[model samples]
Target chain A: MARLTLDRTRQQALSVSVATGAYGISFGALSVAAGLDVWQTCALSLLVFSGGSQFAFVGVIGAGGGAGAAVATSAFLGLRNGFYGVGLAPVLRPMRGWRKAWAAQVTIDESTAVALAQPAEDLPARRAGFWWTGVGVFVAWNAITLLGALLGSRIGDPADWGLDAAAAAAFLALVWPRLAHRRARAVAAASSLLALALTPVAPPGVPVLAAALVAIAAGWGHPRPEEVPE
Target chain B: MSAYAWMWVAIVAAGVLSWATKHAGHSVPESWLENPRVHRIAAFVTVALLSALVAVQTFASGRSLVVDARVAALAVAAVLLWRRAPFIVVVVAAAGVAAGLRALGWG
Candidate 1:
């Protein structure tokens, strides 16, 4: 039974890695459109390694936002990864030095989700899920990012290629799965409205931060229809 | 600084902060993260930020808002998502919509 569960976990992680990593093409192409050189686009994938943050960084920069705003927006988008690390720590066990650092770096949404969804008592299965998904995503994401960057460069005006729309679609897809919760739906609606309202008056990145305040506010306290699974 | 120079700085700074945020979770006492409120807030924050990105990407151009092919493409993408299409298919369809609209000179 344990072996079977472990195999299933691995299969889940593998599929998730491919699905999630493939989105890096959008990230890669969009980063170039956002004005990153091919190498810079690749570096962002290698270093930042989070989908939402990478997109946020490029989105802000592409819109003529300053470096401060770009970094700030990307950082805000990345905050969830930390929480994932917190959730995964016990499952992953203690580590030291480089191994610990690598583990920390790979604690992302797909990895954490795959790990946590495993049978709670199966530490080995959970760990297998986390590492497989994380490392697999890392490799695939970086390689595809390079390919997208190259393709994006030769594609002419981004608007002509509808890369801009693709960018929007990517963001929508990302938030789609999370909107199943009632409160999350409310937060998303509120954030979208707040962002739209602030866009004209505010600086490029400020509106997004302002939108986050809505989530923080709504998320405080509890039991407004008990929170649903993420 | 030049735009590219600024991008480099942003890339490095964002990278360090992102890594640190992830590591902090592992290093912190697990008890700290046990709060339901914290998890809820984090999850909501993810939804909030991504939705905001969707808005900005779809509608805003510079400091102003505009209606364009991107909007139509977003609508298409939303429909595909409602049908549970694959991510690549959703993305490609979106790009195709926008690109096709632009070719028609209709935006």
Candidate 2:
């Protein structure tokens, strides 16, 4: 484990939080496109706090999917956070009952990513990364979402300014760093192609899940050294 | 139901479901967490699902996939990210490129 200084972890947390938080600006604008009021958009960021699910929720609604479909899509997107919780449980198990519940509420992609990005054995830095990134993103995400929603109607067509593209760009930026290896890149490209293929035939949000199946299939059937990081 | 009523219902349901996943994660045993299959699938899911998101957002509009300036902006963002640019720069750059192309009537 590299002796990661607290300062470095804090820097990483702040930077990721800011970047991920800025994503809320576009979300606010897009939610308006989806027919959500500013308060509704703000509430989603504040209460839901999960980026993938929030995006899926609004995207589904924006496309005229019913509320049931929107909820289902968001729920599916949120399942990853559960997986993240499993990974973090041993590390964060010190909390019990309500504190544990609260911790779980904030256990989204950014915090988990920062925590996991640290060298495996550096417990202190990893913990610092989790909490700092979680709180930082929460604060920044809500604030920026409000700003974006307020600006949404005035922006005329959000697509004209590419705010409609903001959510995709944000998620892509987050996924970009993980593509450092060849196999990960392959998985990404393959999965993207799968999603693209499914887009025309599948219902809303179904493509993303079908794409996840590609990874699961590869993982269970063909276990290669590069494909399975240890 | 009114749209507002359905909206609240969806929010509450999604919130409960989201919290359940996270809370359930905390209760899983360490042995299960360390399984090779689980680990590998988790990794794959991260890459694959997020990529799907990018694809969906970049090209998929409503029910169809459409190419537009957003794709070019995503390409620019990917290039900047590959170059190890800061996170904010990459995001801002993508939006700027997309907006620029639109302003030029090419979007």
Candidate 3:
């Protein structure tokens, strides 16, 4: 059983890393398409390392939004990462040292979710899963981003072939599997409706922010105790 | 603000915000982190955020909400997910559906 669990964790880490990495290619291609140089795009990928925020920043810049607006937008979208850390803190509790810094840098959505889903007795294994998945996604994503930026220069307009759709499709692929309950379904519907309604009234990232808030409210409305089995 | 300058500021802000949140629960007494209520909220918040993100991606573009090939593909993916299909299969099938629709000039 232990061996089986280990294998399952490894497989989950590998799957998430690959899926997350594949989406980075779109970011690279789109960043350059948005008028950023390869170095700029790579730097953003390396430093920002958050797909949604990077997309929002570039999208805002591409639309000729001011720098302040772009920064504000990106910051808003990044709020979820903060929440991710809070969720994973108990499951993958870090010991002080360089490990803590490494944990902080890699505390992304997939890593947190995978870690938190592990059994309570398997904390160490869970942390390993989180680290492996996070590092794997980060390294693979940046590498693909570089490749995409170089290839995008010659690929003409990405919009023609629906590269944007590719990114959305990739995200959907990650998200589709998580809606396992009625409450989750309802929250998703509410948040999406709110975002759709606000899309025309807000800027690129603002609708996402509005949706996030609505989802949070929905979630807060129904607080299920944590003792419930996974 | 210059583009690079603003980018740097945003990066710094994100880094700081991320660090603060990760360390907040840890810095507090062990009691707070151990609270059942806290854990519940954390779990629910993550789900909520993820749901919101998925919804936004499926239904909303930059400034409009239109039913397109992506939506159809999402429906297919959702069905497959409900049926407990493998993750890769679900994603590939959805992407294939979308790509096929685009090829047919329906997107």
For candidate 3, write residues A23-74 as lDDT tens digits.
Answer: 6777888888887778878877776677777888778778877656666676
Q: Predictions ranked by lDDT, top down?
A: 1, 2, 3
Model 1, span A1-230: residue lDDT tens: 98887887677666666656667778888999888899999999999998878988988889988889888988987876765675566687577788889998888766776676565567898899889888988998899889889998554454677766876785576467657767778888899999999988975557776765887687677745456334
Query: In candidate 3, what are the lDDT values of residues B1-107, reduced to their tens digit?
Result: 67666656655664455455445533445566567656555555665556556666676766777788778777887777678776556656776777778889886
Model 2: which docking level applies?
A: medium
In the range A35-115, model 2's lDDT, one tens digit per residue, is 988888888887788987898899989999999988888888787677677656545766788888878888987787666
Superposed model 1: Cα runs more than 4 Å off? A1-45, A48-100, A103-159, B1-14, B25-28, B84-88
Model 3: residue B10 alpha-carbon error in angstroms: 6.9
Better of 2 and 3 by lDDT: 2
Error of 3 at A156 (Å): 7.2
Runs of candidate 3 exceeding 4 Å displacement: A116-125, A156-185, A207-230, B1-31
TM-score of chain A of 3: 0.75
Where does candidate 2 chain A have its weakest 10-residue lDDT segment?
A221-230
Give lDDT per model, in order. 0.78, 0.77, 0.65
